[model samples]
Target: MNRERLFSQLVSHSGPFDIAIIGGGATGLGAAVDAASRGHSVVLIEQSDFAKGTSSRSTKLVHGGVRYLKQGNISLVLEALRERGLLCKNAPHLVHSLPFVIPSYHWWEGPFYGIGLKVYDTLAGQLGLEPSRYLSREEMMELLPTLETEGLDGGVVYHDGQFDDARLAIHLARTAVNNGAITLNHTRCTGLMKEKGHVIGVKAECVETGRQHEIRARCVINATGVFVDDVRRMDDAKTENIVAPSQGVHLVLPREFLPGESAIMIPKTDDGRVLFAVPWHGRVIIGTTDTPVEHASIEPRALPDEIEFLMTHAARYLTRDPRPCDVLSVFAGLRPLVAAKNAESTAALSRDHTILVSDSGLITITGGKWTTYRRMAEDVIDHAEMIGGIGVKHCVTHDLKIHGSATVLPKDDPLAVYGSDATEIRELTAKEPEWARKVHPKLDLTCAEVVFHTRHEMARTVGDVLARRSRSLLFDAQASMNAAPRVAAIMARELNWDAETIDHQVNRFQKLASGYILEG
Candidate 1:
């Protein structure tokens, strides 16, 4: 349904809800889905589009933190590993088994990561994807033909899971709706509502229409990710900050850069953190520097140092280094790390999530890895049930397949993106063949997909079309900019925009797309 209808429907609700989640990112979306699955009345809202924040800007791995395993946090590793398995089982279309190769420059490196990976595998028990094994230089060379093999002795192969993070968020939201949860994006929780000194609801604003509403819920969940502190203070003005925001950056390159099924895992970087070079959506995805930031921001950019950090490190390992000019798109995300006792470095903090109840009864869940989001949700909703005194129930997400997901996806390009729902696109193509044609020559995306997103996925603007719905903006920034007019035209028709609105959308998309292109 369109957002206008969503607002009217929510405004029409006269009774209190069993649960009201205040963010549409991973944890919040998961909570909505879980709470609804247990038969609780649910309503969720996001200030921006779904997955517009840190949720969409992930490393795209649903892995058990191999780094956590090194830190001797076996329990967390075990938990993430099991969740990784369940995600693959439930949403096989979005999440799947991926092989990772840790290439060794020194002789000891292979055996070192291999042994650790063996322990990682053992922890998974029956849920493990594949056993970690030592690969000869020949085997490693065969898998990753582009690696610089001068000092490479051998490598280790292990199994992990990778997924489309933003798409998964959308699926979770849809699944939640399927299970009777009402949702809206572009809706912000401006304040918390209290009665007798306990939070009873929230004061939310429709960001688009400038309309205000009081959403009275029996329980309010603060799943605002790195922005949890902002929501927490709404309940108590004097509370200390609870989240230590950690920024991470990633660069997207053409898939030819990796040209391998197995991803490259640099177990350690110059800064004592792990980085990944993974293949995602026909592109090579390289990332991640963990540096603590003083504040959380909605529009976080990759610092120049972070860009250098990723390129310098990644270039060292590849046969042909990916220069800034070679980068197709660069995006940054913040990790919501729980504030620790005199934590010196965000990299030193735990990736595990935290759930806290303020004195005013605002339930806040924050600080976790994307790999363990479902578990994080289950924990939050368990507490949600406890705090709200709602009936206790089990989390069915362990085996719950996401919406539009399938047992098998199409083997071809574009259509494969829709997973089991690819047939729907095929139907759209049948009606108007031009909808199936690419907006421009370089991209493989079809116009029909844009129609599908607006008609079904609640995409209302050019940014939603490029950034989230189709990921055109994420894969290739300049190309998305080049295709903006055509995309805006399609959106203008679907959204019924006037000339000024269409121009605004095209200009806004262009400005945003430029950020993804690194400056020389």
Candidate 2:
């Protein structure tokens, strides 16, 4: 993933591409990987770093939607369940099975939910993980030591997939690049290039450098997550908005709050939503409240009420209540849900993806979750072939190995999340002992990981390195702030940042990270 070489290719390409994708998040990158692996000439551009928006800010679960099953959207649940299984198979290093316990307080709650989970397991069929089983009160407590137990009857445990969302996104981008797709971060799509009112290409500008390029494509796919409508309007000004943005917020807490391998799942909350407290990267992440938002943002903030809502629920479930002061970090992501006519609540809207070909032949794909990204890519590219008149190539991403894909990893090694690439990083640490130094006292991140991401993973800014590449900012905001100077220094040495650039990057990251901390 050499940005300089890719950028030169973007500038010097003589002919129009078979596919030009806008928005380098999950959908776009998936499309790039799917299309390119099928021998299509593909190019993708993102305004910011990959997964900077909703893709990175996820609940970190790769599972069939249990809530959707209760709502009777059986098709969605079935599709997501298949995709979830495939993701675990394809990216075993990043995605794995995680146990979830649903504590039951009432007599009837056990049978009711237990039957529902049985159906869930049935839907997954051969691809399912361990089956759901009933647990006695003693058994449940052993799994979740901190669960509140005043009227606890028993519990049911089920299996789902868990992963690092941003890390997977980076892998997806790398897989696309490995398959010969040019993916550029910090490249903004300014406008659509139209001939005779037919969408042909895009006018993009380099955000780092002011250089611009007119990239013509036979097919232009808009996979821009929450900001899909923004790109659609470039084709037609009067394009009625199709996306109804919904915000989901999560809070990161210490592992002591959930000091176990299994996670806690609240089947039903006061607002008819589900809440989860899952463990990731040595931290406990409890989320998420789904609230409707008018517009999408690059950096979404957790609402005061949303924070309070989570705190109230956390107190209800945990024996030890977590207060605002206990919060380590908080983040928010907006869903690009396709709007339903007369849809009163965003929660009722569809999680299934929608692909629309506009009057000008612009192919737009929106309204999907992270789990079904590969399927969405497959569908949109099939549509592109029919609409854009590109040569047909069947989808090959189902069995394609993501970059750094590995089956087994050492459990004690903190760099295991890097998959096979961890060995190279370990060699770097062995060669240069300074690279192995911890970035912060509280975090497992090392300076070697920062240098590696900047050199190979298209990491450009301190935010890109801390927020996405290493997930330091999401893990602990204050610690990430304290470690910013060290990270900027390492990136400076690797990417040749001057003293002024180092100061600017560190200051900018501190200001951004401060918002993730709840004021005591």
Candidate 3:
């Protein structure tokens, strides 16, 4: 997890690695872990901080694709269901089971979804959390006190996995590093290194120091989510684009909007998409509108229409309607969906991953959900070994314990998300009393967490700490903006930044936080 040590390993190694992966999001990080654990010398490079893109901007659900199941994608649903169960077992500190109530306005709605969810449960088999069952109108209201009850006949309650997406991404990177993989953030891949029309390695440059390295490898993997085509074109200018970027947006609201342990799921929205209002880290996340986009950006903005769509739907389900001013923060993520020929809408694209080996032997893996990243990694590495002539090493990640995996954390502990690492962080507060002080009055982030992320989590920028490491920006945009000066000061002390750099960090973060605020 130490950036300097990892960077040294990248440059000092003379021989080619077994695998060199481009992209540090879910799929790439997963592949790094899978390959390294199997005794392959692996290196993974990212253009920015890990999960700075779509991985951190998820709706925070790790479940079988419910909408895909309705679309008759049984194979994907089955695969995701199995992976969901495994993730809960593998990363117990980050993943947890939660209940979701699908409210039914009409009587038939309850029976219809009830039967459908039963099939969903049957597909999960022994791995199912709790069986889906019908709940009476009175019972449903008790579970969801904030739900609108006028036309509510009853509801069907089901089970799904919930987690902190960015936190999980960090754990995956740590797991890969623990298995001896070289993972470098803020390193951009400039171009492919080919030998006589065969892919060999990559030309990468350190974003911070501008030092370039010609990194050779037996195999190179392009797992760069939505921007996969951008890397593909590097290998061959005539490479056909496989990814169709689909943008999904979410809005954060106060806990009072939900005020319960259970979540509400609208099975079918007006646009035939599913919407979820899930509780996470003491805030309610009401989201997700999927809209087609022509291009992808590292920081995608929540469109006005997407924001309005979520608020409109939130008003329909919640007794307390939300306003544009009520929005605490808004964020968006782009899905790296493999384009389908003649596919009318991005919604129709499959969640299953697609693997392509170019004529030059460059392996590209794109198009998969966060829930099934492990399976996608296993599949890609198996392909890499076959093409690269590496000896067979069967996948061991199915039972591999991710870094920081531990028993259930105490419910009141705020740092429970850090799992076993929470004990070390707690010790920091005891050693340095100033570290215990909250950075923002409205949020629980503290100076110790900021320092910890900077030193151990490869956090180099203020945005890396606020946006991904601690999730302060996603929880409350204005509070994070107000807290930036304090966070930057703490980071400056740790990273040895001058007064000018500190001011620049604070100002830069404020501008970034402004995009998350609707009024700004």
Candidate 4:
């Protein structure tokens, strides 16, 4: 996970490559691993740090798209569920099942959802994930004691996998590197190189050193999430714009807001969107309003209107009304839905991915969720090999074991921690109290986890360490702001950065972290 070693590998492999992947998000990283594991020399370049885009801005769920099932996209749902199972098996440390409670208000609501959940369970029968169960009102009350019991009839509990999406991307990148793939972050692809109207390579600039380089390859794949269209337009002016950005936002509050082990899923809302109050990283995470966005940018700031929208809906089930001040942090992400000619609402747009081979021979892949990243990578690589005249190899990612997969705690172990509850902190503190005291003297995050971020997680900045690696920024942006100086010092000592560099990183992190906090 040494940044220098990774950069050295990329600089060493400047010759012609079997595959050159543009964009270092989940799909691109997955493709790199898939292709490189098959013995193909691979090079992956990103405009910013890895997983600095939508891949890190997800709801952090690896479940089958239940909404897709409602839309009767059975094939997509089944495919995603199967992939979720594979990810759970292959990366158990990063992907684990979380129980979700779907509250029912109407008399027939319970049976209606129960039947659908039964169908969902049937699809995932052999996948080894826990099946759905019906919870009586009393059981529901016991599970979610804070829920308002005014109109509750019963509930249906189902199991779905949850994960740290950015960490998963990091692990995929590490796995690719371990298998001989050269992956470089902070590397931007400026232009596509062509010979006789065919894309033969790419022109790139290193953001860190401002150095220019050209990577020659037989095939170039564009897996940039919302930015795929930009790369496509570079290849062919006539190429249609295929990405419509959809904005989704999440709010973080204290765990005392809904002290529970199970997540609450609000199925139907007046605004035609589903709401979820899930426990994550020792705090409660309530989210996600789907709004349309025209521009695609990292560190998307959540709007006040969107914040109010979520609070209005979430207040229905909570014991106390959650005010704007209760929100510890907020985040927004733009979804790259493949743009249809007359697309209306981004939510109605397709979640499925589209891979296009342009006239200039650039393969652009976009429009998929975190759960289906593996499948998206397979499809993109399959098309890349076909167009580049390179032989395709069978994907080994299904049975492939990611980092920490072998060391993941067993499911039946009594000491196993579930969800992002305080159990994780307690376990870490019990094992490494000195580390815990250094990172989070007030909270539960440990110094060991911070060290682990630099040693194994490739965390280069305070924002990267707290925001993505440790979930501190996601849960409590203010706490992360307070911890930034200390984290910067630790990173400086470990990464060999000087005082000036540490101060620069701290200022940058503050600017980024401040955007997530609501100001009067």
Please list the residue runs of candidate 1 whose C-alpha ends up more than 4 Å from where it truly belongs after superposition: 410-412
Per-residue accuracy of model 2 over 332-407 as CA lDDT, tens digit each: 9999999999998998898889999998899999998899999999999999988889888889989998888864
Clashing pairs in 4: 242-339, 435-447
Give lDDT tens digits, candidate 1, residues 1-520.
4566667778788898989999999999999999999899899989999999999999999999998888899999999999898888888778778899999989888878888888998999888898989999999999999888999999999989988888888878888888988888888999988999988888988886778989989899999999999988888889899888999999999888899788999989999989899988889989998989999998799999999999998888889988878899999999899988977798778678888888777899998878888888899999888888778888788888888776457434566656767788789999998898897776777898888888878887788888887778778889999999998899788878999999998998898888899877
lDDT per residue as tens, model 3, 1-520: 8999998888798899999999999999999999999999999999998999999999999999787888898998999999999999999999989999999999799989998999999999888899999999999889999999999999999999999999999989999999999999999999999999999999999998899999999999999999999999999999788899999999999999998899999988989899999998989999888899998899999898898899999999999999877889999999998899999998888678999999998999999999999999999999999988888898999999998997568645789889888887888999999999999999889989998999899999999999999999998999999999999999998889999999998999999899999872
Instruction: Report the C-alpha lDDT of model 4 over 108-143, residue by residue, as the tens digit.
Output: 988999999899999876884788888899999999
**Model number with the top lDDT:** 3
Q: Count the backbone clashes (under 3 Å) in each candidate.
A: 1, 0, 0, 2
Error of 3 at 129 (Å): 0.4
Per-model TM-score on C-alpha atoms: 0.98, 0.99, 0.99, 0.93
Model 3 worst lDDT window (10 residues): 405-414
Each model's C-alpha lDDT?
0.87, 0.92, 0.93, 0.82
| Lowest summed lDDT window (length 10), candidate 4 | 413-422
RMSD of model 1, in Å?
Answer: 1.3
lDDT of 2 at 169: 93
Candidate 1 vs candidate 3: the lDDT winner is 3
Pairs of colliding residues, candidate 3: none
Q: State how far residue 472 of model 1 sits from its true place (Å).
A: 1.3
RMSD of each: 1.3, 0.9, 1.0, 3.4
